[model samples]
Target: MTPGRLLVTGAAGFIGFHLCRRLLAEGWTVRGIDNLNDYYDPALKRARLSQLEGHPAFTFQHLDIAQRDDLHRLFTGSRFDVVVNLAAQAGVRYSLEHPHSYADSNLLGFVNLLEGCRHQGVDHLLFASSSSVYGANSRLPYSEHDPVDHPVSLYAATKRAGELMAHSYAHLYDIPVTGLRFFTVYGPWGRPDMAYFSFTRKILAGESIPVFNHGQMQRDFTYIDDIVEAVVRLVDHPPQRQVDWPADPATSAAPFRIYNIGNHQPVALLDFIATLEECLGRKAQLELLPMQAGDVLATYAEVNDLAALVDFAPRTPLARGLAEFVRWYRQYYGTA
Candidate 1:
């Protein structure tokens, strides 16, 4: 049940890089696309790309998903069996400064991906949706059954929009689509804008790190390996028409499904920071700050559906994941 040919958007990104590596290892011909924007350090993106440069099964394309011409050309040229769209303008707070970036990458870019899949006869379409879609909801464990119409940030709104867009495509074209709501994903080759990565950098530099929401936040911090494992399993198993899907608001007639992929255990921000300090053996100078706009107070996922479908679950603890990240960070950046 190997995917014949897989196209992964955002191939240079944190999660995308891991997914590409895993697919290549599983003996799949993988084509990756990325705009390689300067949202953060493009050098880190290049370093991740370097890992897959020489792989026989791997091919790289520099294209932005928002550009309809480039996207159409890529899809029409390559007959992709599975198209995983992970490329987007990815920061929550940054959406405030650059609202159009979100509209372009998350909104228009997603539409382009869907169009490509719809016209190109793509078999399975797996795209990155964020747990941030559970915004303004205080539920202990966020589930696919929960109503997520109240998104707090533009970023969350766009991701939720993506789920809807995927649904429309699935319903209209019978495209098998699976939307993954990733919860606090972190590990090696992670985004610098993420708190865990930034904290590691600042802690080692002996600089003051901002503890947002006065360090009262909690997150279901999922590790990268666990995430990639779930994604790979899903690549072979596309969504089917849920025959008994309830006539409720959440369930639809489309060949579409959404699943939460996260460590079920929610760890507090303070505890996460403590784990980072322990891993790095350095104390972080803390600067407690109010909650930033577009930031949720906490996120905890309910991945029971994912388990039932794939017999897989994210089980990496914060300590182990952060330790691995710290090790990579130190080695990558020459931080002692």
Candidate 2:
């Protein structure tokens, strides 16, 4: 599809910021919105927005998607060819205390987005789901075909609920929709709440980094650029209505589909830390902790379906990605 006006929620977020920058560089007229909540740091969010404010094709707004009237107004006012929902109350541990925030952004906000798409005649709607949806599934390389019914965390539950909501909208209204289950995405401008980011901070400060599950964990740490590449490639290729639905949960008779977006390789936690140490040239103080509630042991993505559909290939090495992130961290924080 030709470049056109696009709406990207959570434009100040980790993935959202990178995506908006890439879209603007490619000549897409983009409208980026975010609640800019103090989930982490509003300063970081503002900094991300600053990077995009210079682009002529990009516009920023401080609207919360959960607010029905404001979201409806934005949808009706703008002619967006593609709509990507990245706004959500993200963080597994954080959700335990703030369940209402999860409900507001991930559930009610998603419904509002679906309604907006339904009424506004959106050609394609894409939303960010998470590998956390694989909650209790011990299966290696989590596939979109796998049933994601058991979510350990409220955050994961909300993400899965958003997927169900999108499917419902697609079935009832024939809206072309795609759901992306992104695995442990990390890189420059990443979420501070994430393990890798926090670990970096602590390692530099000579503080102990918490290693949950007694360092017996694995993660499919995907690079931000890899995630951006997958989204851009899949943007125009909306799923068509499947008359004969495949024998998979990912595809349906409606104009909807789901795919796993990840590196397709799970790294052991200890080995990941070693790589981080190598990048920072400093050893981390490890604090082994028991398995935390609502935490998964590992996350591996089965990206064959994504590859078949959009030829998605995530090829960033752990070392290289971490090196780049470390470089940015030092520069951004004025640390040696």
Candidate 3:
């Protein structure tokens, strides 16, 4: 049995595209929206949309979430049971280059989603946050309990800001909201701007791939399938306002909650690269570089809370995931 209608922002994006397909397969009616901006390649966005276009249960809308009037009209026109917001100007390094883009999408656009949900009386609002919010906190396996006061980049700051902003709306308007702190999501049809994707491209072209932080950094890279599964399960379980909620940042008196969705297994950069090399049957020309600004040395997620709730965690092995990605890359690029 399928649920009611869903409005997925950034539907043409990597995660969003996968999520829409999942919902549609489960027999849910989904309306997907994407501005299709030239953040990377609009052609990729179109390709994602092409898959969904054939599905009768899926509809695609072309618009920016930051556009106030359009967003309002969208909410006014449809009675969406859930709104999964995955749209934003992504890339931590790119955030330094264009700070205002973060303001436009992460900040301004986030508010628009909040307003739309508040007015539309949405049942649940699930939005994308990031592991980067761990920022200056030197904690391993970052938990929602940790204080994220210091953000290293404009991108991290804006994501943290979005969480705070969502809490306010959840408190005042009583909107049921869940902020998911995603830890380095990667898989087939993933974003080209991401390190793994770009590295694969450069490696195939026989060019030097930038090995940042001297290839010392580690990440808990979660597969897209695991991410989609967890989110789909969580949709039916919106947080209820707790009578005895703690003052801790993890929970609230409002109908709001946050969870870290990750594989929880941190893989070293060099090991990851080696696995990729095996998958592609080619060695990458390495350019060892110092850690870029606004970049963290490591990311590990503590998904105990999510496990307690859903009895599930991302369990995909890094090597297996990389192999799948490499397979898709070759097929998609017609190099296989």
lDDT of every model, 2 decimals: 0.90, 0.94, 0.93
Candidate 1 Cα misplacement greater than 4 A, ranges: 248-250
RMSD of each: 1.1, 0.7, 0.9
Give per-residue CA lDDT, model 1, range 101-178, as digits (tens). Answer: 999999999999999999988889999999999998887799888889899999999999999999999989999999
How many clashes (backbone atoms < 3 Å, residues ≥3 apart in a chain or on different chains) does model 3 have?
Answer: 0
Q: Residue 189 error for model 1, in Å? A: 0.9
Error of 3 at 3 (Å): 0.7
Cα lDDT for residue 96, model 3?
A: 83
Q: Mind giving the per-residue lDDT tens digits that candidate 2 earns over 145-184?
A: 8898999999999999999999999999989999999999
lDDT of 1 at 210: 94
What lDDT score is found at residue 61 in candidate 1?
Answer: 92
What residue pairs clash in candidate 3, if any at all?
Answer: none
Per-residue lDDT of model 3, residues 1-336, tens digit only: 248899999999999999999999888999999999999999999998999999998989998999999999999888999999999999999998899999999999999999999998999999999999999889898999988999999999999999999999999999999999999999999999999999999999999999998999999999999999999988988989999987878889999999999999999999999999999899989999999999999999999999999887787898899999999999888875
Off by over 4 Å in 2: none
**Regarding lDDT, does 2 or 3 come out ahead?**
2
Give the TM-score of each candidate.
0.98, 0.99, 0.99
